[model samples]
Target: MFVSDSAAVRRPRIQSRAEATILHADLDSFYASVEQRDQRWLRGKPVLVGGGVVLAASYEAKAFGVRTPMNVGQALRLCPHAVVVPPRMSAYAAASEAVFAVFHDTTPLVEGISIDEAFLDVGGLRRISGEPVEIAHRLRAEIATKVGLPISVGIAGTKFLAKVASADAKPDGLRLVEPGRELDFLHPLPVQRLWGVGKVTAAALHANGITRIGQLAELGEPHLRAILGPAAARHLFALAWARDPRRVETGRRRRSIGAQRALGRRGRAPEEIAAYLDGLTDRLGRRLRAADRSCRTVVLRLRFDDFSRATRSHTLLEATDATASIRHAARLLLDTAQPLVTERGLTLIGLSLTNLDDAGPRQLTLPLEPRAENTLDATLDDLRRRFGSTAVTRAALLKTGEGLSVPLLPD
Candidate 1:
C-alpha cells in the first residue's frame, strides 16, 4: 500500500565545520586480502578463498568477473588461472583483531559494523588528532603498516555519507564528503547506491522512471511514499538529502547473534544437513554463553538453488542459552522446513538466536541433582577455552565433516 507524509520531508540540516568528522573505514576484499597478505606469492594475483563456494575473491579475481559466494566451478570458468585457497579462520580473526586495535587507538568512539568495517567518530579530537581527513589517512597507513591490509576510508558529516564515501573509494583509497557538499556528491549516483535500494526497490523505482538518486529525491517524500511504501520511502528520501542522524555508537550490543554457512548447489542427505545444524547450534550456544546472553527465538534460514530463501522460527517456552535447548528448537524448525528443502534443493543454511536478554547468574537449586547437560556444556566450553576449539567435537561433526567455525567480530 502507498502512503504519503508531506510534513515529514525536509532537507538535511547542515553541520558546522567541527561536526563533519565521522569516518568509515572498510577493508578491501577482507578475507581474500588477508590470504594474500600472509602468502606474498599470491600478491597481485587472482585468489579465491573457499572450496565449494567462493567466500572472498581478491580484486584481481573481481577484475576477471569472479565474486564472493560464487560457485567454485563458475569462478574457475571466469578466471581459470585463479588460485583457489581454503579459508584460514584463525588467521583472519587475528588480522581483524589487529585492525580493530588500530581503530581503537585512532578514536575511543568506534562502532564496529562487521569483521572488516567500522565507523569512527573523531569529532572532538581536532586539538589532538588534527582534522578527520588526517585521522582517516593515518588510520589507513597504520592498518597497512601494522596489519598488512589495505583499507579504504571515507570522511563525512554523517555516518551514512561516510559509509557511502568509503564504498565509493574502494580497493584501497580515501574520500571525503564535506558538510555542504553532501548532496552534490550523493544525488548524481545511481538509486541503487541508496542504502535500502535493493533489487526489488530499484525495480520499483525504475518502473517509475526514477533511475538516479536525484530523480528519486525530486519525486518528493509524498510521491516516493506512494511508490515505495511508507517506511522505505521515508528512509530512502532522507538518505537522498543526506539527512542521516545516526551517531557512531561504541560498546553497542547486537540485537541478535547469528552465523551462517554456504553450501554449494548440491543434493545432500538429511542426516548431513542435521549434522551441520548441530555444529552451528553448538557454535551459537558457545557464543551466547560467552556473551552472557540468552534468546527466546531460534531461527533457521535456508537458501535454495534457485536463489530463493525461506526462514522458519520457533520461540521457546523460556529464554535460555543452553546448547541442548537451542539445538532442539533449531531441529524442530529445520524439520518444518525440510519439506521445502526437498522441493527446492538447499544451497545455504543459517541460524540466528533472537529476542535476546542477559543470561544472569544461575539460581541455586538445593540438593543439586547434577544437571548433566549444563555441566557438559560448561566442561566443553572450558576445555575449548584451554585446549582450543578442536578439543571437544561432537561425534556427528566428526563423521559429517562439519565446516570450519569462522571467527566473527564482537558485535
Candidate 2:
C-alpha cells in the first residue's frame, strides 16, 4: 500500500516555531526501489533483493508478510510471484549518492544515518529558504524528480519522533508531528516503537500487561527500574514521555566494516567452512582497503541450524588492511569456534573488522600496491574492477558460488 499523508504542508496549526524543524528523510525500500526504478517491469510488484538472505523487500512484498533478512526460500513460499533480483550494490550506491546530494543541497545540518536515511535539521532555514514543512516538500519533490525515487519524510520536534513519523508515512509520503500533541501521537503506539525495546524487552513488558507507550508512561521510573534494570528503566521512562534531546550530528566516522554469508540449511565439512571464511575475509579486506581504512579487530560470527548464534573475536596489536592478516585473524577465531560449530551444526558464517582507522603510512596494502601484500588479492581486485566481479574468482571458490555483495556508504 503506497500511503500518503502530506502533513508537510500543514494549515498553520497552533505550535511554537522551535518545534517541528527536524526532518527525517528515508528512502522507501531502498535497494528494491532502486531495482524497480531501473526496471520498469518491476514497479507495482513484489520485489525481493538478494538470492540467499533477503536484503530488502518492497512494500508490495511486505503486504504478503515478506521481510528483509528472511531466507529467499521462505519469502518465495509467502509470495510466490515476487520478483527475486540479485542485489546490484553499485546501482544502489549510485542512487544513494544522488539522493544524498539532494539532501546536502537542502540543508547543511544533515546527519546521514545510513545509505538510505538521514536526519536533516532544517531549523534555521525558514528565512533563507522557507518553513521546515515547505522545505521538506521541496526536498521530496527534488528527489522524486531528479533521482526518480520515492522517499518518505517526517517532520517533528525531535530526532526520534521524526524517525517514527517517517516510518508511519512510508511508500512516498510525508507526515508532521504537531507540537504539544507529541504525547497524543506517541502514547497510542506500541511500546516496541520506543528505542531499545527489542524482542526481549517487549516480551517482558507484554508479560506484565504493559504493551502501549501510555501504559509504560503510567508506570513510575522506580517501578520500571524494579521490572527492568536502572539503565533501561531510565532510558524507556524518558522516551515514553516523548523526550529525546539528541541532535542531528554530522561527520560521523564508520567504526566497523563487515560481511556475512548464509550457507543454507545443510551442514558443511570443516574444509568447506574454511573456504567460505576465506571468501568472506577476502571480500571484507578488499572493502576496508577500498574505503581507505584499516582495522585492529577481526570477529567471526556463526549461526547454527538451531537458529542460535555464537561469536568469537581476536584483536590485533596493530591495525592492518592486508587480506592475509585479516584472513589469519579470522581463521584463528574460527578455529576457536569449531567445537561450538560442530555441536550446533553450522548454517552461516559472518566476519567483521572493527576498530577501524584512517589509512596511514604504517598501514599495509595489497602486495602490488604496498608492503608484503598478497599479489593475487591485489591482481584479482584489479581484474574484477576492470572486467566485473564474476570475471575473476579464486580457485577455492570455483563451484562454491561467490556470495552476493552487500552495499555500504562511501566515506
Candidate 3:
C-alpha cells in the first residue's frame, strides 16, 4: 500500500547547474479519485468510470487487469464486483483546473500535455527551490494535501527521461534521474520505454536482439533509420539515449481545436442529423474563439455503424471563427458527404478546423454581395459564455426538429 505522507518535512539536498531538471506530474487514478472525492461510498473499492468502454479504472480495479478503453463487458468479467459509474466530464475538467493551479505555483513554464498531466520547467526556479528533487517531493506532498488525491512526480534531465521516471514512480511516488547517470538509468530499461517504440516497433527491435534501451542506443542513426524510417528512427534513437532537447513552451497558441460525437445505432432523420452538425459546428467555433485561432477549412468526419469512415472538407473564402460561418461551411461539407452518411448507418460525427492562424477582425469583401447579418453568432456566443453553453441554442436542434442535439463542449 502506498500511504501518502502529506505532512512529512522536506529534507534538504545539494544540486548542480549542469543537471537538467524537468518535472512530470500525473494524477493517480484521476477519474476514480474524483468519484471518491464526490461520493464517500466509492472509496477503497474497485471503481470504473465509463459505460460502453472503460475510460478509467481505480487502482483497486487494476488487480483484475481492467485497463482504459477496454469493453465494459470485458472489464466486468475481470472484476465482477467493480462499482461502475458513468463519466462526469465536467467534474474531471474542474479537477484538472485545480491540478494546474498547483503546477503554475511551481513554475510559469508549464506545458500541459492533457487535463491530467503536464511538464514543468523547474530549471528557472532552482536557485530559489534548493534542489529539483526537493521540489518534486514538495509538489507531490502539496497535491496529496490539497487535492485529496495522489500524484506521482518524476524529475529528470529531459522530457523522455522525465516521462519514464514518472511511470516508474507510479501510485504516489517520486523518481529522479541524477545528473551524469542518464545512460546508466535509461540503458537498463526495456526498449519499449523508448518513445515511438509501440508494440510493433518493440517486436521488431526484439527480433533484432535489441531488447534493452542500451542495445537500441548502440545502433547507429543509419541503422535505426533503415529499420524505422528517418523521423521515427531518429526520435527513438535520441530518446533511447535520453537525448531530448525540446523546451517547455508556455502560453503558446493552440494549433487546432475540434469536437467529436458518437451517435449510437443511428437511424436518424435528416433534421436530427442537421442538428448534430449545428451542435458540432457551435462547439468547434467556441473552441476556436477560446484558443484565439481561426481556420480556413472545415472538415466533416463520419464513421458508419460498420466501422467504415469517410471525411469531407471545404475551404472557406476567408478565415472566421464565427459560429455561423463554421456551421454553414460544415453543413456544406456534410452535404457533399451525404451519400456516405445515408449509405451506412452513421455512428460518429466529428468537426475540425484546419489551416489555423491567429484570429483577426473579419474583413469585408468589396465585390461580393452583402453578407448576411452575423448577429446570431454573436448573440449565441454571448449567451452561452454568460449563462452556460447549453443556455441558448438554435431552433433546428429542438427534439421535434432535424438535429441530433448531442451535447456540446464548453465555450
User: Using Cα atoms with residue i matched to residue i, what is each candidate's TM-score against the true structure?
Assistant: 0.93, 0.89, 0.82
The order by descending lDDT is: 1, 2, 3
Question: Which digits, one per residue and each the tens of the lDDT, describe model 1 over residues 8-111?
Answer: 66555444343679999999999999989899999999999998889899999999999877899999999999999999988999999999999999999999
User: Which pairs of residues have clashing backbones in candidate 3?
Assistant: 271-402, 271-403, 272-402, 272-403, 272-404, 275-403
Off by over 4 Å in 1: 1-18, 361-374
Q: Candidate 1, clashing residue pairs? A: none
Candidate 2, backbone clash total: 1
Top TM-score hit: 1
Candidate achieving higher lDDT, 1 or 2:
1
RMSD list, candidates in order:
3.2, 6.8, 8.4
What's the CA error at residue 297 for candidate 2, in Å?
1.6
Candidate with the larger TM-score of 2 and 3: 2
Winner by lDDT between candidate 3 and candidate 2? 2
Tens digit of per-residue lDDT, candidate 3, span 1-411: 111133253222222324857988998888888898889999999999876667789999998999986778899999999999988877888788878898899888888877788899888776898688888888888877877778998888778788898999988899988887777788899998877789888888777777888667667666777677899887887677566778777876556566776666748776677788888887777667766677998888898878788988889988787787888888888788787778888877888888899765556786754444466666777788899777876677655322222222222
Residues 59-113 of candidate 2: C-alpha lDDT, one tens digit per residue: 9999999987899999999999999998888899899999999999999998888
- Poorly placed runs, candidate 2 (over 4 Å): 1-17, 361-392
Which stretches in model 3 have alpha-carbon errors above 4 Å? 1-17, 199-211, 264-274, 301-314, 332-346, 361-364, 367-374, 394-411
Question: Candidate 3, 278: how far from true, in Å?
Answer: 2.9
